[model samples]
Each structure stands twice: as structure tokens, then as C-alpha cells.
Target chain A: MLITFGAIAIFFAVIIVVLQLSGIKDRDFTDYAVGGRSFGARYQAMSFLNTWYPGAMFTAFGGMAASAGVISFYVLSYSLLTVVLMYLMAKPVWIWGKTFNLRTQPDLLALRFGSRHIRTIAAVVGIISGVPWLVLGMQALGTLFQHMSLGTLSFAEAVMLGVAVIALRQVWTVRMGMRGVVISDMAQGIVAYIIGSAVLIGLIVWMVLARGISFDALDQKMFAIPSVGSAEGPLYLFSLILTGAIGGWCWPYIFVRLFTADGVESLKKSAALAVPLSLIFGVALLIFGMLGSQVPGVSAHPNDVWFIVSKEAGGLWLLGLAGVIVLAASMGHTDGNIQATGAQIANDLVGNYWQLGERQLIVIAKLGMLALTILSSWLACLELPALFSLAVLAYQGIIQLAVPQFLGIFWKRGNKYGAIAGMVVGFVVAVVLELGYPGYLPWAYGLTSGAVALVVNLTIYVAMAYLIPQSQAERRRVEELFDLIEGKRSAAAVSKGVREPA
Target chain B: MSDDGKTNPNNHAAWIIGWFILDAVVALAPPIYWAFDRNRTAILGLPAVVTYFVAVAVFITASIVAAYLAEARSGKAG
Candidate 1:
């Protein structure tokens, strides 16, 4: 059952790729890159589904539930808070991006603080945190479709193959930019949701009509290991839940979406729908975890639950559906990470190096994204590190940025001296804590660096704010930046603003 | 300068921070003490099991407030 489904899934994936390559007309690097940054609310809604229903949610997170206890649910709880996180994040990031006329993550940081130091710090952190998750995804992809009796691809081979496929997908990405990725992400997202719902409904029917097991029984089986179902720690569980909502609050890729929105209203519209969309669609993966518990014979790895169920129910058809969902998850995350990384590199490094034109830099940006895709995919194939911990490590790294930048924006005294020193120190501290602690490294086992970094960061900020002499020009630069963000701009101000090429 | 224009979600973000410290004390002290010191005072001799529920409640409460404040701030349009 698993083998047949996998074959069918491969065929469907090939077809989807061929159609995307041939059928899409406006397939330029830019369009392919950020979906030309013209995504409407409806398409945006679809993109939300693709973004939320990721492999970790479907595949690995279940495994966490199996091993880690009820806290497995905590991974998901963070998702609910996204409603508030997105709303808080969207407009400010949107206004900043539109005003700066930015395209990438590094660009956002560099432009905001007007500091190469900030950009460099951001890029290094992006790569460190991002590389591991890509590897973890590759690991899951390797493990996916294990129903193949031939075992033509061992786990290593599968990881390699998956990474290769991701790299190939980016060929299209390299030429397209956010335009291509977001469009496909939206398409994949909507299709995954619709098809995922159908597939799940189909499975539920089989369980009810064919197997004679009730939903209540299945729920019992899932909850039978109550301790396994719940997460550990008092505050850590809450922290995990909160992290779901706000941890990714300032994620660079998500911020990019804000820039592309039609206006603040689109931002509002997207935010309104993003939460429930994530919670519902993401929960679809949980059904696989639930089913995995019921089938007593299946002793395969816990992550294999989704694949096994897909094969068991409808064989090839369900396998194809599940495959597509995983692909969409990997692609959506990869695209965002790559684009944000590319944007940072292009704006901070490449543009600075060559002082290139918009046409040239945008082209370079696409290539840079391609580079990042390959690098991340290769890392994914290695899969030595654990997933969620790595994600926490990365989250901690990015959230580190939130401290300095947040202070710089909101507080009058948040000067460059404090911003730079605080960011640097916070980053070093995070790295040391991550490295020194064993479980803490790739996953957040010991303590959340968000608190430490924020605390250490604020302490330095307050001290430096008192010590550093406030410069008039620097003050003007920041005030003017905020004013432009608040839309108090003249025609001259608008023209002189956002150095996006003549 | 007067704090009227744009507020940081840090107001509630701070509360999340507070809960994190409480969790560290409740959840980690035993293991931390076990690893470093054989001293019972390090765990503070507190029951580990109940801490999980207490911490979970605190985290959930803090998250709700954070989410509420973040959304409310966004609605204000900077």
C-alpha cells in the first residue's frame, strides 16, 4: 500500500512541476521571486495555508508528541497566538518595507539601523539557524514514502534526493524571485488545504464505514499515553505556546509578505484569516498522528505515521496527496528563508560591493536565493541535528534582533552605540548558551535565550543610552525614518526616499 | 520621545519573560541541581509534577495577553 502510493505521489509531483514550468507566463526572476509583490488577499489567504501546514506540523511534530509527552500539543499552541503575532507584526513591517522599498531581510535590518554591522549580524544568524531546519526537513523527506519495498533510496539516499529536488525547484525560484515562490506557494497552499481536507475526510470515512472504529475510540487511543501527549516543564510549555504565537513574530520572510500586501487593509485581511487558517489546516496533520496510534502493527518511526496512514487508506491516491502537502511545506518555508536570506545578502553585501542598478541587483538577488536554496537543501540532507531545537536556536537567533531594533524604534534613547553593543553581546551570549548546553543547542531544552538576550540587550541599551552622546544627524535620520513610516511625507520626501534605483 | 507614536510589544513580551523565569525555577531546578549539586535545597524540595500544570497555565495566560496587546497595537495604525 505504501509503495504504490509513493509511486503515484512521485508522478503527481512531476506533473505539477512540469505544468508550473510551462504554463506560467509572467515567469521572470522577479515574478518568481516575491510573486511580484502584488499578491491579493485571496491568494494571500492560500499562501497562509501553505505557510502553516508544514512538514514539522504534519511529520516531525507528531514524533515529538510520541516521545515528549503532551507538550507535543504545545508546539501547536504557539500557532494559535499567530493571530495576535501577525496583527502586531504586519503593519509595522509592512509600513517599513514599503517605505524603505525593501525586498529582503538583510535590507530591512541594514536600512532600519543604517548599519552594516546589523546586516552582517543578521545574515550570519539567518544562515546558522536556517541551515539546520533545512537539514531536518531533508531528513523527513528522506524518511517520507518509506513504503517503497525496493528501498532504492536508503534514508541517506532519500535525504540526498529530496535535497536535489528542492535545489531543482529553486531553478525556477532563481529565475522567479518572491513572485514565483509566493504564487506557487499560494497555489500549493490552497491545493494542499482543499486536497488535504478531502484526503482526511476520505480517511475518516474509511475508519468509520470500513474499519468500524469510532472517532471516540481513536481519540482514546491517541490520548492513552497521556503523559506522552503533554509537554514537560511549567513555564516551558507556556513559553512554547507563546513562542508559537510570537516567536516567529519578526520572522524576515513573514515580514516580506507584509511588504507585498496591497495596503494596510490587505495586511489586516491577511492577519484576520491567518490564525484560524493555520490552526485548522495544521491540525490536519495531527489526524495522521492520531491514526498512527490506532494501528497496533505499525512500529515504524513516529514521523512515518502520515505516510503509513496515507498508504493504508487509499494507497496511491492518498500517498500522492500527502506527498504534495509535504512538498508544499518544504517549498513554502525554503522559499521564504531563501528570499529573506537573498534580500539580506543583496542589500547589505552585493549592492554594497558593486553599487549595482535595480535591474542588476534584483537579478543578483534571484541568484543569491538560488545559492541559499542549494546550501539549505544540502544542509537538510545531512540531518544530524534535531528539528525543533534547531528551530528554537534559530528562533532565538532572530528574536535577538527584535531586542535592539525594537528598542531603536520605540525608545527615544535607543542610540547606535547601545543598539550595536547590545545586539553583539546578546548574540554572543545566545551562541554560548546554545553551545554550552546539550539539549539547548538545536532545541530549546534548558532556557529560552529570548529572555536572556532581551534582558542583557535592554541592560546594555539603558546603560549606553545614558553614556553615548546623541548625534543630531543620527537623531534626524531616525525621526525622519519614523515620520516616513507614519506617512508624513512630501512628494520630495517620497522621491528622495527608498533608494530603489531611478 | 514621549511614548505616544509606536509602542513595543515588549510590554507584554516582558510578561512572557517573567513566566520563563518562574518555569526555570519550577521545571529545571531539580535537574540542574542534580547535575551540579547533590543539594536538595537546589530543587528547593518542590514537587516537580505540579509545576508542569502551573507553568502551563502561566504560559497560556501570558500568551493570551501578549496576543491581545499585539493585535490591539496593530489596530491603532502606529
Candidate 2:
């Protein structure tokens, strides 16, 4: 217990020291919001993977794989597809961001559509969707706290410890802002994915060689995909992948990273680099969960498989390392979430209404982060529904941004009214269906409520775009913006002074 | 086509369309696992479905890297 707790304490201390010593000087809202659009391939890639793959990837997704067999491979599909989406979206978004000095995702919407109302709507909707996940993330840390405690602390005490760690992590986040978040994400991502991969690999080797449980002995169905005729069915998986691929980048934290890259080409390189790392980390966790299913006590509570396996393999010390891995990942994501959500509130929502100076905006953003931490911590203490379920519900709302954000880039006919209306109607449909049907919608016969809502949302977006025409000025402005994006994308690489790889 | 009607390899439309095709292939291909997911088949000591997923991952990675390189090349040329 001492070894575990001591290691965690050291880990926390190291992160703080590194963050303080990094020399992140935020001169204005630009630097505070996006690191001045200067991150290279490594920082952007690692920071993105860090924020994208939260600790829940290990706990919830891993647990799902262990309990549900091959059905869990949906994550693998969605993850890879999301990267492809990233590669496609990154270049255009980067150009626009540079051209307009855009910071938040809502800022992009407002710029693209030429409407502050769209920005306000995007901000409000983004915060509403994001708050639930923030609350859920704090609760997830409760699980990490319990595991690290090794039965020494009561559940309530563990929850408190979890909240305290998150609040403590926010200190650097508040000071450093986006620059701090991305740099720390790179550092913490290394600890979480690279070190975590090594530990899982060791655990797997032990499971196979020492325990004598071969893949052949595992459940036959574990290797099989669920059919459309099965209880869970094809649409369930399809909806998840659709939501994941499209909505994955729509998350305010993830989308804003597009602006942080140094150049358009750097964005592409980041996507290429992020793929294998995300794949290795994702597959390793899935394999860990699958192998853990063979262990005795772990199969019963799949969520605790990583901890149980660690303890069995190398005692409390290993379990302590495992707990640190999960904490690193969870904090990496939670901090980015707080920073992005807070930035959106201050820069887009509040700044639009009131003209605040750079220092005032920074102060407001810090206060927002502080307020969010307290609220999320308070909610984490309360009895709430499952963390994973709440997260998926948030994704349903986030994905609604796809049509207006993604398609609006390619198609200039979309107006602010359509963008705002699509998001509002999509969110309402997702909420109504989620509340009425919970997870899967019987009304759609095995299709996820999210998928059904998305269909309605897209239909509304397309219809509104055609029916509600953009004004002549708005149309002309959009065309000029699109031409600029295209021009920048194809312009000579000499401007960046970096030769393209042959 | 350009105003001269010559084929343009560096055309943004071609790249975008090609990317979309690749995206559709990857995003829609996973459902094919349903047809060959049975555990009776094993490949290189791993389940056949697992092997299939590995193949798809490799394919997606190669395609994206190729696209990225091509874009980089085109951007540099202009």
C-alpha cells in the first residue's frame, strides 16, 4: 500500500514540477487558447491521442471487451475511422483557423457562417453536452482512487481523493491554459500509453505462459462478431462507429487541436503518427481485458480487470503502477476538457456578449475552470448513472455538430440558421430518444437512439440549407473563404520552410 | 477539369474524392466481419476475425499515409 501510494505521490509531484518548469508564457488569449498554433508533429499527435483516449478506454471499453466478447472490437473500428476523419478535416480547418485567428470550435462556426448567433448557440450546446462528461470523468477517478487505495480507504474517502487529485491537476491547467494542457498531455500521454503498454504486454505474457490459458481455450464467441439478428445487432455497432468517426473530432477538446499545429502538413503528419500509437494503446488494452476474462476474480467484475490482473501478476506495486496509468490518462483528458470548455465559454459565449481584454478573458477562463472543477467534483460525489453511458449520451449530442462543422467546410450553402437549428433539433431528438429508450431504440428496431437522431438531424440540416438560402453577401463571403482555404492548402511549402517528405 | 480541360493530378477535387472513397471503404468495411467471424478459423495462432481486423488496420494506415504523402508532395510543388 505504501509503495502504491508513494509512487502516485511522486508521479503527481513530477507532473507539477514539469508543468511549472516548461516555460509556457501565454502573452494573450491566442497563446492561452492554442499555444500560438506552433505545435510540431510529436506534440500535436501525442496531445491529441492523450485527450482522445481517456482513462475510460481502459476501464469502460476494456471492461466491455472482457465481458461482451468480440462485440467490443467496435472501438478498434471507430478509432481507426476517427483518425481517417482527422486526416481529411485537419488541413482545411488548419488553414481557416490561421486565416481567421480562430481558437474555439464555435469560433470556427461563427467565422464560417458569419454569425455571432451561431457562435453563441454552438458554445451553449457544447457546454451543455460537455458538463455531463466532466462530471462523469471525476466519478471515474473514484474507481482509480479505490484501486490505488487497495482497500485501505473507504469508498467515500477514495472519491474524495479522486476529486482532490483532479483539482490539484487543474492548478497547472489554469496557469498554463492550452499551452500547458498540450505540453502536459505529451508528457502524461507518454506515461499513460507508452508505459501502460509495457505493463499490459508484461501482464499478457504472464497470463499466457505462467497461467497456461491459451487463446484457444477462450470462449469461441469471443472471436465472433454479433449479427444483425443477435440481441445487440449490427445497427448498434454501426451507430457507434458513425458517432465515433464523425463526432470524435467534434468534441471541443479534440477539434480545437487542429488549430494548434504549426502547418497544414504538420496536421497530416500528426494524423499519421497518432494512428499507430492510438492503435497500439487501444489494442493492448482490449487484449488485456480479453486475457483478464480468463483470470478467476476478474471475470466477475470486468471493470476491475486491470487492477486484479496487476495484483495477481506482480502484487500491489504493479497495481499501483496500473492505477497511476489510469490516473494519468483520466487527468490528461479531464484537464483538456476543462480547458477547452472553459475557453469556449470565455472566448466565444461570454466574449461575444461583452468585450473583455486579454487579461480579463484569461481570468474569466481560469474562473470557469475553477467553477467547473467544483461542480464536477460535487456531482461525482452524488449517486449518478453509469459513467460510460453518460459519455455515450454526450457523444450523441456532440456528433450533431458534424453536418454543420464538417460538411459546412465543403459546402458553402449552409447558413447560420440551418447550422443552429440542426444542432438544436439534433440535440433535442437525441435527448428525447435517449430518455425515452435509454440505450437502444426499439422504435427503430435495434438501431441506437443516437443513430436515429442523427438521421433526423442530417435531414433537417440538408433541407434547411437548400430552403433557407444564404444572403448574397454571406454567399460571396463563404466562397472567398473556401477559395482561401484551397489556395493555402495547395500553396508552396516554402512558406513553412519545411520540405515535404518524398 | 481546368479551363484547358487537361487532367490535373494535383486537383483538390480529386484528392478529396479519393479520400472520401478510402474513408468509405474503411468505415464501412468492419461490418464485413459478420460474414467471417466464426472462431473455427484460426490464422497464425490468432483468431481469423482478429487477423482480419489487423489486416484492415494495416490497410487503413497505409492508405492514409499514402494520401498524406501525396498531399504533402502536391502542396510542396505549388
Q: Identify the leading candidate in terms of DockQ.
A: 2
Worst 10 residues of 1 chain A by lDDT: A224-233
RMSD in Å for all candidates: 8.1, 5.4
Off by over 4 Å in 1: A1-36, A67-69, A148-152, A201-232, A297-300, A377-392, A408-413, A440-446, A466-469, A485-502, B1-78
Which regions of candidate 2 are displaced past 4 Å? A386-390, A443-445, A488-502, B1-20, B29-31, B73-78
Docking class of 2: acceptable
The clash count for each model shown is: 35, 0
A341-456: candidate 2 lDDT, tens digit per residue: 88987998789889899988889888888888888888888877666567667777778888899878778787777787888888889877887887777546467776787788
Give TM-scores of the second chain, every candidate: 0.39, 0.56
State the lDDT at A417 in candidate 1.
Answer: 65
> What TM-score, over all chains together, does every model reach?
0.75, 0.92
- Model 2 RMSD in angstroms: 5.4
What is the DockQ of the complex in model 1? Answer: 0.05
lDDT of 1 by residue, A219-271 (tens): 32233212211232223443444434444545666656756665544554565
Candidate 2 accuracy as lDDT: 0.78
**Candidate 2, residue A324: lDDT:** 86
